[model samples]
Target: MGADTVYVGYVGAGAITFGAPNVLWNHSERIEAILRTRLAVPVIVDPNEARFKEIMEQKGNGDYADSYKETKWFSSPQEAAMGLDNETKDKIDFWILAAPPHFRGTTIEGRDLELEMIKLFGNKANYFVEKPIATTRSDEPHKVAPQLAENKAVVGIGYMMRYLKVVQKVMSIIKENNLRVMMVTGRYACAYKECHKTPWWMKSQQGGPIIEQATHFCDLMRYIGGDVDMDSVQATTLEHTEPAGEIGVINVDEQAIPPEDRIPRATAAFWKFDSGALGSLTHIVGLHGIRYSNEISVYADGYQFRINDVYTTPVLHVRTPADDSKEQVFSYPEDDMFHNEFYAFLSSAIKKAGKPPLPTEDLLSTEFLSDFADASKTFELTWRIRDISDAHADKLLAQKAASSKKASA
Candidate 1:
């Protein structure tokens, strides 16, 4: 390979990057195609010894794995950095940070290691960090976002739902029709399986389902409908796990846990947008199966529209007086949103020097997608809902206590 060949490095080898149906699983074969026919980049993955052996065993026997045989595996990025000579380091051109959401923090060694890689790589490499960029407790984005933007680095945050073709089409319709937004509603009722089967359901670990999972809807609420007014949000959460209510006690290996009690069973909240339009969210992690029901609706002055089964089977429906009060439906059942999103990042990251202008900022120029800064706004809202909801629950408990005292008197 030539010196200019973009060497891709991955920070984490967990479910999001390499697990079935995730970024690598769905697109590794396509990455092979791109490598063989289009680009000649090498991929380096850093997983601990155990995970490294597991990946080699699981993926090595497959035919496509041969394409990745040339891939270099390391126990950690620091090991790779030390093993590679300065000349070899210059070939490294992109880093993909896909660590679990909870492991991402300012002081977390794993996350700090990736940041050191970014600082070491500098403008020489681009980045694609997955979201929630930082966990609720860490506040790492505040520390990381400035570093990337200050370097004028090319980066992409994994708010890929915004890249859904159906989502874009609906937003375009809103613009073309000259609609004034009035309200937006989003429901992300999903099963335990869809949450990747582990600490995801634990609020302490993954910041609950609202910040970790349902955040996509919250981001879309800002993108399609309008900005959220932080002062106007009212929210509450519910849990149903017996004996360990509000406390996560199930081990990662436990398979028979009640879905609702594992994380938050349900969180119902409403917020007023800066435009004075109302926005509401209903997130429940209590379904069964791989295909969870996800939908978002937008109601404007003269239109009512919705996108349903957004994660799996994306369909759009519109209702207007001009249509005789009938619904106009649109579907993009065959769209591979993940592949499309990865390819978009690849286009900008793989560009030749001085050929044409490319996106030099952390956020891509892609429509409706969020960068770190944009995502922080939504993360802030999630915490806001959390605080308000907890307070409300406490207030109710206090009232009940006061009533009991009066009855005893």
Candidate 2:
């Protein structure tokens, strides 16, 4: 909260840190990497002390544990906010809202709470929050979106994939070539059975696989193909007690989710972009670990471009003339996209303050990445898919109920 130092406030500590059950979800390493780049910055973290202590114990008496305990820790965000004076709050430079997507009040209310915490900063501090931007379809992301611009703070949604070097190179090519996009296809498949443990298995908690995990590809699809028309979107979902079972089988515990609330094992969504480009996304919670393919392919007037495994190892391939006539490949073997993402944020924060000088890449790259407004559109599309699928299922159930009553009569 000072001219010489930046203060960071973290909400929902463990879920954003190494404490998450899925190590893939952990982002402590990225946060630590950011801290190293900035000088005299301190983080105030709020979470259950027991979970923090558990993480420390799990790491043994190593440097990580020692570093974990060094930050100012509190029990919860409310307690920390209450303890901080206005002057201290003013000194806060950044806020990271990393709470679990589903916990704290489902995805909708929980995300609202995350934004509410940032609003506590008086909209003066730059903030970064985790993705799937909104939890529920009903959330009015548009209403709060203007606050970021009014506050003049660099607010970013955690779509770190946009910062990948390979992605950047491909974007550069697309920009330089002035290509007209025709269609975009994306696939995000993962082993949710292994990654999802407890609360995550519930759709109410996590918004299902399409909203929570595959959203990265959804964002990418929009990024490459441009904005989508909400009404033009059509989606279908499939869930089974036995994925390999009969197609018409229907089984559920009494008074449970009525089929719509179940965590879908597979989902396919299609939508038309404002550019008139057709976009389609398929997400399957099958396959384990790196064995699954995560890629986004774009077909333009003169070229075919793709980013394969954007999360793990980003490899971009380009086929010019749009016919696979000539092929080119670009690989980022040591891409630290998370580090790049934070570095961009810190750079933008510093630039806004005008106290320090940093590289231009930071400012330029962050400028290119999707902010709350841009990411909100993609979130809305994903949420709409779930809503449409649920409505269809509900209609079927109603029809079935009427048929049963008539038969009994």
Candidate 3:
């Protein structure tokens, strides 16, 4: 009780995933080990799932190790929340809302859980929701915008790449170069197709792969594009879902939902930003990114920045003039997304009125993800990026120009 040991709890620690929420059912022990090793904190497991029992089962063919047998467990998240007293809760600093099933393949359900958690932890300063805060619609942020304005509670929707050191450097270069975003393209893929799901995510009830899985890149696209309004949007999904007709599926099944329509094998949405920046996104199945990587490429004033395997320190291929063509590996200290991401939430919640770890304006990051999810499920979304326009967007250009204005003046 002396100085407040930040006893943060992972609401769904067992749901630690691979790539994008993939290893949930099995990686709890390993994830905990990583957290313990890296963050200097114990990541306790807490879930009502039968999978929690596997820790103490045995280490033979299908069992876990002895050390993990002691893996923390709880009846529910609320119980875990209540266990942290005022002193502990105050020190808790940030609440990480992980749990793969909650966020996987569905934005609406994920948002519902987020709203529920929001209501549950009313006074907490920050909470982390995974990508695609809303799939069916993104007005939720608009709904909560009041709370943000009133209480100033910051919500970090796990767009961890935004915090990467290399990305930050490139963004600085873009801002410094007076460059305008002319064209942007991105592709996010996994090694295999979205073969199966927890039933909830695949159906329209939860949301679809685009929003749940692909939202990460969508948000990154918007982030790199300087938050311009997404316009002239159009996309198509793959008939990859088990039940082909399910919306948003690119390579899972072939049957359509409502047993009528036929989905495509992938989806692409092409649009223009308010900064006259054009964006094209392709979220497909079986087509992994570069080197089986995740990629986002941006073309601007005679230059380009390609970020591949964006989960970690993405390889930044900067294309400049013949003499200046150099591939600089931008450095990022916070290699662990989960750790830095949570640290950001901690800073935002504990230190109010400062530069937030995550954006507090309009939940734009998650909304970008929501668009793809919504697009896949509903097959179309009327909602597009709101504030960007080509007219007086000269201001953004001015920001770019001002960096070099003195040199030219």
Candidate 1's error at 109, in angstroms?
6.0
List pairs with backbone clashes in candidate 1.
none
Query: Which candidate leads the pack in TM-score?
Result: 1
Q: Estimate each model's TM-score.
A: 0.81, 0.80, 0.62
Ranking by TM-score: 1, 2, 3
Stretches of candidate 3 exceeding 4 Å from the true structure: 1-4, 17-85, 99-124, 134-136, 189-194, 198-206, 228-231, 236-263, 286-293, 311-313, 321-336, 347-409
Residue 332 lDDT, candidate 1, scale 0-100: 68
Across 244-361, the per-residue lDDT of candidate 3 in tens digits comes to 4234433434433552222234556677766778888776545433234578898887787888777745667788754455665554433544444444455455454232233242
**Candidate 3, lDDT over the whole model:** 0.49
Write candidate 2's Cα lDDT for 257-294 as tens digits.
54445666677889899989999998876664446678
Segments in model 1 whose C-alpha atoms lie over 4 Å from true places: 1-6, 21-27, 33-36, 39-43, 53-69, 105-110, 192-201, 239-263, 286-291, 352-368
